[model samples]
Target chain A: MSETTREQIRDVIGAHANLPVDIRELGDAADLFAAGMTSFASVNVMLGLEDTFDVEFPDTMLKRSVFASVDAILEALEALGVALV
Target chain B: MGSEVRAVSAEQVALRDRLIDAGHLIPSGVDGVYGHSAAFEDLREALGTRISAEARTRGATRLTFPPVLPVRQLEATGYLANMPHLAGTVFSFDGDDAAAAVQGTRASAHEDWSEFQAPTGVALMPAACYPVYPALARRGPLPAAGAFIDAGGAWVFRHEPSTDPARRQIFHQHELVRAGTPETVLQWRAQWAQLGLDLLTGLGLEARLDRANDPFFGRRGRLLAANQRAQELKLELLVPIAGPEPTACASFNHHLDHFSSTFAITGAGDDPVHTACLGFGHERIVLALLARHGLDPDRWPAEVQDRLGAPR
Candidate 1:
């Protein structure tokens, strides 16, 4: 994954977080919900991710589980063949 | 905080209970969720007759509509934008053999088949006002000034799962909508806001009119709430149901040109039709009346009982 793509994802997540989120703390597999991301705030993050990446999310990608955390979102995007950066 | 008269009837209670027993009414057992039951038909028919009679007095046309609407049309109106969470979509199988396989099923399989077919038709309508704009637009330009349509509807769904009868998933809405010149539409909405408040008051409920924001959406939905306050798009007549906070039974909406522009509905001289709608959630009103009044209809004031045409 490109460093730019990683930065964009972290930026989207950090923007929605009420407090500063530690980028290092989120592995590519961490649960977002368990990390305190709200469902609605996560949607905003997803929309931001979609816009920044110029990628459209399929219906299946819209589920809550895929967005459970910063790591999960990146993994799901990778699975969808969305190239980082 | 203030006390109000009760106006519930034994008949209403009996009907509600019977429907619940029949599984027609699926109560959420929560405070605000509204449920549906087969018994609603009787109450709805009666309400429809009463509303139609009132429409005649006002020289309005009575229009009835089906409960389901095309998903495409709803999308065009931006209903998905304002109420995506509440809107229910109908899905169907694209599988070629799905239908035939269902028809070939045995009795046990038949039940599953029916469930499979349930998604085919269209989205269930969440509000009555939705279907009217497109129909009105199909007709040529609005009259020189405006037009009033009295519509009675049922099977409207909301996603709220409150136990309070006041907030049901499926309920009836007796609506009056106006489309035309800006003055006409706004005036009609304002008039109904007062009229609805009076009607609720006469029903023996202590009701008040207040500005209402859109139903809660997501986190950003709070933005929608703020916008509603800024634009003053909604006014609701609310009555205390089960607690200190009041439940909205009727709402008057000044949609401006939202529907008209979205649906291409124009008024005389090609002006965008200014649209407004007054929606009465009938079941909520009934619940408010019941909560305020006792279960005995005969005990209600003569004037209040007479208006509902309850037999003495």
Candidate 2:
């Protein structure tokens, strides 16, 4: 479930980031914003993540760095107590 | 009727071209600034008169602030933390004649003479409501029901430079600000948001109320944006002023405890006051009127002219 969740979130992030490079080519720790995730596009990515997880991000988890990289994203999810499969 | 209302492809682009051609707006030598014609000013004053009448009906007190805002008061709001990109602080040369001469030479040579100028300890007021919080703070406590202030159509500044005529550097906001309990302020703003759409639509302009977000800063701002939308903290009354997308002409913001906590406004039971503001962009409204109705106010639909009152 954890692997699936991570992969699912990552896929949504890549699709919405609108980056020039393929999200699959980047390392898990690579910065998504550095590659081009605009503040506008990030909203779409956020909504996508919420749909995939069946959870709405609480206010405490709403911060830029959480969406900064794949690793950072997983850390945020872990804080939500999602088990890492 | 909705489909009959022609949604122009590029309203801003079209507005700028047509407004200038019609002598409704005059170009100033600065980006984002324009000189308004008498007709345009009249539109603002007329709108102000109508809004003022509504405010009086509600017993709302009216106040107008100068264009400049105290830098300290502005900083206290912590507005810069999220939207530093949008504000413009006032600054000046505070040096001696010799320093002035040096600055003069630099300025003449097109060098960065402005570097020598000191901070004016103030900034151009970015929104009509910026001064309201501190003004309320000066008074010890709020009334049990709290208070509402009508800030009528004053000049506010933003750093956005745009060729879109509706997007001016300096614009006017006829704002109604309320400070009260969470229920009082929020409900009032929500009411006005819907009323605003009805008013515009009644005038034959295709208007709608939609959930909206402030142009918050950076990646961190994305979270702010999402949170704002999730809570439905903002409301915008959009009209197809320019482009395929509707443009927001008026905005309603629910500050919850943001402004009260900043300015220390306390209500009954000594709780932090909640704030909400409803602001209408005077110039944008005028442009919308011109775009939808004819530029000649005399030729406007009888109903719109009746709502706006007689033109000068």
Candidate 3:
């Protein structure tokens, strides 16, 4: 994966989320929800990810836990056979 | 937490046992069916009246429906398409008496005797408000101010089996439903959510209104659930009834043109009237109050006793 893929995701998350911490502060394993990410905002993140990756998330991965962290989202994409450039 | 770690808690089990022992929950040995105690039913009914009185004052017409919905109505509502896993269709033995006898004999012992029964072409009403749209549609067109109905019934069935006391198979839903201009319905839902929170909190229960969703079916339903939350179409008023997470005692739903299109309901300018419903989960609320206070309603907080008219 290019630095662009990861940074782009971080950018979208930063743009979509209404939270205190800067995007740079969140590690891949950091629980975004615990960091004040909300279900309502998570939807926008999903929309952003869908648009950014050009892949639609299947039903199994639409749970709140899947959007718990950046790492979890990456795992879901991997499960969907998505290869981030 | 994931469902794997969702085993019933001791507190929940104890409360269930306490209710059963107190004769509030009469067991039928079946997974879902139960005989409700008069006392318990009284509390539920009183809660309904007390809660609904405010909506009625706002000109919500009252309507009650039977537990079973005609198959056609469910079809119109698109319920099966979205949540087939949760659907419980009613069936019967449409054969001769001999067939019935054979089925009965097979069923006499602990066996799958239901195999003899055939589809009766009806479905158990999943939500109390499912039948309202079609019925209201049949009335031709909505009034100029649009239609508002207080509708629901008991024994709505959703085929989700669990040890969770808060998630019962059979329960009552009394909803204050609005079908009118988009703004009106949206505002109604927002207002009632506050009303629901206030009502529960006023009784000294820990109630909070937050984003929630219906248990939709697979694949496509995930998108639907996400879209719903994204649009903020559903809100739940929850109280910690049984376990770690608070149980949903009431819900506010805004069905944006979904029902209007399904039923051809329209508001002024003949535009599709947006719809919303605020539903109260009867048994869940009663159990929450009991769990929060104590078994005896008499021992509940004095202010609460007066508010619900429960004897102190």
What DockQ, on C-alphas, does every prediction get? 0.03, 0.15, 0.16
In Å, residue B111's CA in model 1 sits off its true spot by 13
Stretches of candidate 2 exceeding 4 Å from the true structure: A1-85, B1-11, B270-272
Q: Which regions in candidate 3 have their CA more than 4 angstroms from the true location? A: A1-85, B1-7
| Candidate 2 residue-wise lDDT, B49-116, digit = tens | 88778877887898878999999988887668667878999889888889999999988998988767
Show model 1 residue runs off by greater than 4 Å: A1-85, B1-46, B93-121
Best-first order by DockQ: 3, 2, 1
Error of model 2, residue B310, in angstroms: 3.4
lDDT tens string, model 1, A1-85?
4467667788878776432357567776776656666434566776777777777666546556665666677787788788766
User: Residue B302 in model 1: shift from native, Å?
Assistant: 2.2
Interface RMSD of each: 10.0, 6.1, 5.2
Better of 1 and 3 by DockQ: 3
TM-score, structure 1 vs. true: 0.66
Per model, kept true contacts as a fraction are 0.00, 0.29, 0.29
Worst 10-residue lDDT window, candidate 3 chain B: B1-10
lDDT of 3 by residue, B98-150 (tens): 88888888888767877678889888888888878887888877887788888
